[model samples]
Target: MFLILIKLAWRNILRNKRRTIIASIAISIGLAALIFGDAFMIGMMENLIKTATDSFIGDAQIHQQEFRDTREVSMTIQELDEVGANLAKEANVQYFTRRTFAPGMIASSANRSAINLVGVQPSTEKLLSQIDDAIIGGGFFEKANEHDIVIGSKLAEILEVALGDKVVVTVVQAKSGDYFEDWFRVSGIYYFADAAMNSGMAFVRLKKAQQMLAIGPNVHEIAIKFTSTEYGQDKQVPFWKTYSQHGNEALSWTEILPQLPKVFAMSEYSKYIMGIVLFGVVIFGIINTLFMSLYERMFEFGVLRAVGTRSFGMARIVLFEAGALAVVSILLGAILGFVLTTIFANIGIDYTGNEMMGVTVQEFIYPVLTIEQFTVYPLAVFIFTIVAGLYPAWHVAKMSPVDAMRRSF
Candidate 1:
């Protein structure tokens, strides 16, 4: 009986070629939109994370417990050699670099602006962040000890300085509280999408910055990059615990920027909201198609009822017809979604220099395709299509032979 119903449903849809094609096209569009939308959101979020991390921020950071809270120059990481040894042995750690920081003033001939002075190893810092790539004018530190300095373009305009121009750096010694000042020729100027970084930060070699601050062989911070971002995102991993000893604190980017996870959660809620809106709109179209088919066959249905065809069998055939239509839609939609996503994944969409959620977008975003897009969305469309068939099936089944025949021409 089930096989006979399936055969009848297939034949019934085939009888009206134009109606079947139109219904299938409408449902296919819905499924395709869902699949492509999911991929696009995933890509966007992933790109945001990459931008936030790679723009002078590593996947994770380590510091003395109070350095984060106070930004004090005195809170240097202890037992540096042992910490370096452990990091070298850790498989998940791809790159780590020593850094020192101080609050200081950069004085040009015309103006003086507050600065967050950073010390970094030139080679390792290049591998860890996009600082080298961000140099729009001048150049990055050619050698770690070259007395070269890098400042942002915004800060340059504020101070009225240009490449090779001389400037004075002023900071207090950590132990003596005595003011120390030095002159440096600006060798590089970098530009970042974030306004904060542009106007308030400067970078010099670790050797020179440490000398300026009078903290010999001691670093205030250790920046770390993991082999994969997933490792750094998991805060509970043993690598963090192992190195987070001896007055040091290890933190993933999530802990460092607490609001990022909240933004990610909100993005997920948007996906469900979009899905509901789409399903609600497409459902009406499905019902309209089913009703038109039912009314067109009213005379035939009345004939079937007069011959003692059961109500359950008539309802099952209509539901099967819905499934058939859904199957065709799912196939076409899946193919279309796959092709579009794959193309974008390769060519990418440029959103460079655009800022979002407090981070600058440094590169292009590519749609990220997943197996669930094909499976979950198609399954949802099939189920929703079957549910949509119910009202039309009920309306047809409950009609008496006389009423159905009278309504038909």
Candidate 2:
């Protein structure tokens, strides 16, 4: 019986090809809009997180509880070796590195500026951060030389220095709390394309920074990169319990970069809001089209009913027509969406100089089409399309055959 209704519905839809085409186009466009919007938002979020994490924070970090608040060289992680051993035991940990940081001054013959001097282990840091990839000229340190340093391109431009040029870095000693200065030759100039990082930070050998700061075998931070960023939030509790003790704490990217979660959440919520607004427009289009189609058939509906066609059957025909339209439209929309997403995902959308929420994206963003995007969005539109047809279908069923037959178009 339902098959017969569907056949009748299809025949009726074919009678008004223009109306059906118009309605189908509306639904198809809506579906495509949703898919594209979701993909774009997801891509932006992924890029933001990757740039923020790989550029500096990594997936997590371990620091003295007061280190974040005070940014003092003396608040160092004293048990670096033990903490490393514990981190090694975690299955999710992919790479880890020790770093010491201080706010200091860098001076050259032509210029001077305050900078964040970071001391890093070159070998481990290569795996944990993008500092290696950020090198636009010269080379990353092959070995820990006390005099070698990597400065950001912006900093280099400011100090009027290039690779092999000497720049003096000055920092306060941890022991005496007195300032000390040393000269480092620029081995590399890196461009992360972030104004703040590029202009205000420099990297040197870990041992050299330790010596300069007068702290023996101690690091202010231990940055870690996990096998997957997805596991970072889940692993934090256990990692903290295992590694953090008195005066120390372990933090996930979300914690260390508090703005990240807010930006991510806001981006996602904005997509939903846009989707709802788009769907509202689609709903009205569907309702208007379906109503016009049904009204045009009022005389035919009356003739069918007068000839003993059940009102229930009349209603079924209208609903079946809507369902058929939705199915056809959604399928075509999905195909279009797949083609667009695949093309863009491969090529990527580059916004090299643009900053989102203060995080600079130094690379291209690749849109991701998740399983939920393919399934949930189409399903929701399909259900809503059917619901939109319900009132029109009910109107047709309520018609008195005699009155409907006499009613003019």
Candidate 3:
């Protein structure tokens, strides 16, 4: 009977308490590592997504169909008021800001450098991006003139300009193609993890940029913050379709930074790699333990064979013993993993100000635990342990009663 085999398997492992405990611990450590590795990878990917989006790139962006390719000021978003109304009514949109970018030159008395000028509404920009918090000197649009400007600290160093210094800006008008020039006072200086941003970008008020560019209230891009970042990643979301109409294009951060999704895809392989590596060591440990246990109980196996027990029944007993060991190990490993993940989830791992591939992590990462981590991982570990017992099971079943009896002495 299966019940009799189960009882025999449990009783046999208990014969050498220390050896069984050690084997169980070995498998348990591997299972626990698998669980922890899955949790950590999930947390890190989330942090990467959050950082990529929150670092001046919103969860999603809306733009004219031809705008991104050209980077020409002429390709501004159409029906600006209608777009604003729709965004206001959309439940998924938390905050949105209008922006226009220009390739221009900024010059101070000491030096002049080519720059990318970004126009923004300071109040709404703070709601969407971390530029407000990244300021190292002065303030972001603190009740200042329409001519006020915020330049990067790196740009400031290049231009030899500081807060309160005068800088001349030059850009071509979108429609007439006539060159326009203006003077702006440097109101603030900011620092970001991206070297390009710190070295080449400057911020000025939307109103001033519009007036100078000869475009009235038309923006090249509308960056959107969503209710949840998940909505941005889900390509099937109705939000993308609804707004991606009327000669415009709507895109998630994933689409904007195509490289990030590739990196995310690569991260998925880490779980399988970790499982293989951890359980690879455990396979040998389990086999050795089972072989040792079988040899010590050779006299009992010999008596069973002599009493007319079939080979299938004997092999099944060894397999059942492996299952029992796996069950105990799974329990301990699950408990250990859950405890470690929970403790760190509360504490969180600090990775702020760390940049990778032009994106910076601006917050702490809390490990995310899911049902798959506990259920699927443990089940896989159990199956792996069962398979590891096969060779030992086969060896024990094929031996003759006389040979088993002789090995016992």
TM-score of each: 0.93, 0.95, 0.93
Candidate 2: 10-residue stretch with minimal lDDT: 235-244
Off by over 4 Å in 1: 143-145, 407-409
The C-alpha RMSD of each candidate to the native structure, in angstroms, is: 2.1, 2.0, 2.2
lDDT of 3 at 26: 90
What is the per-residue lDDT of model 1 for residues 262-357, given as tens digits with 9 covering 90 to 100? 888897898878887887888888899888988888888898887888787677768998888888888988988888889988999888878877
Off by over 4 Å in 2: 235-237, 308-312, 407-409
Q: Deviation in angstroms for 326 in model 1?
A: 1.3
Clashes of 2: 0
Which regions of candidate 3 deviate over 4 angstroms?
407-409
Ranking by TM-score: 2, 1, 3
Evaluate all candidate structures by whole-model CA lDDT and list the values in order.
Answer: 0.86, 0.87, 0.89
**Which one wins on TM-score?**
2
